[model samples]
Target: MTTARRGRPGYDLESLLQVAVKLFNERGYDGTSMEDLSRKLGITKSAIYHHVPSKEELLRLSVDRALDGLFEVAASTEQLDGRAIDRLEHLVRGSVLVLADRLPFVTLLLRVRGNTKVERSALARRREFDRLVTDLVKQAEAEGDVRPDIDPAVAARLLFGTVNSLIEWYRPRRGSSGAELADAVCKMAFDGLRA
Candidate 1:
């Protein structure tokens, strides 16, 4: 059974999060005030407060949603049995899906500048995620699936850089799909970038 927020009467947490994420991306996190959020949602400021304690909580929730999707991919990859290269491909494709599904939130996450304590904390968590992926890249190199000449750190950065850049070019369309993009990414990354 699901329950709605007490006394809110209509808006639920998920809907509130969607509105909050869109506003956060459009206005920039620091630029957005709680009053601004309430105005955009066409609700009272206190109603907004009823769902989320503060603007910062909204930011934290949005980023956590994106991060949770990403870290789930990494954990699932670790569980699957295969060569490190195969697992790497799984990670890449899963990450693409995460970006596609949570595009707005992840976009906000990647653009964070560490200007506030919340942003700094998000940056630190993002770095930890990067480091975990870097280790996977290193494992792939040891298995001779990746080029030895290129630094694993550099390769990791480049791979994520390309994936992260998808938020810029990838507009969801009716014809082209995320799986198609993920397949292309895997092929391009492994066939072209591999040793």
Candidate 2:
């Protein structure tokens, strides 16, 4: 009998993604396989596949969830107006919170190796996100809201680099939810990093 055939109930889509993210980080995306995932979840491979078409689909969905919140913040009314500095602050704060809320998924998105077609697509979307933010940074510099010494492209990457790094050490505390962690991220990224 298959391992999953004898185990407890299989996890739902969200639960599966959470497990997959953890495994992707632990084993490296290239190292993990459907069998490994099924074994880990104690569910049949078919059961896993039923929830997600393929491992690539799981990766795509996970990355999209992380990116959606970010894109929303970029397009928000608060981001469209105000001093370039304020808009940049909103972007940074919103990004930090989104990253915190979706840390595992975002971390997985950042670690994509392009070993699969799905990863390459995710990489492309990530570049688009960077491009949008870079434009904002450039506008901020033009408005004297940010230090002009730094290149906007470089600044955008640096800001995201700092915020995304939260996944490396951040964990939800006993009383904190992912949203709370996101709030903390916003405070540190904008208020703390600004000149």
Estimate the TM-score of every prediction. 0.91, 0.85
lDDT of 1 by residue, 46-102 (tens): 877778888888888999888999999989998999888888889999999899889
List where candidate 1 sits over 4 angstroms from the true fold. Answer: 1-9, 193-195
Best by TM-score: 1
Best by lDDT: 1
Worst 10 residues of 2 by lDDT: 1-10
How many pairs of residues collide in each model? 0, 0
* Weakest 10 consecutive residues of candidate 1 by summed lDDT: 1-10
Instruction: Kindly list the per-residue Cα lDDT of model 2 for residues 69-111, writing each as its tens digit.
Output: 8889878824375777677767777777777677888888888
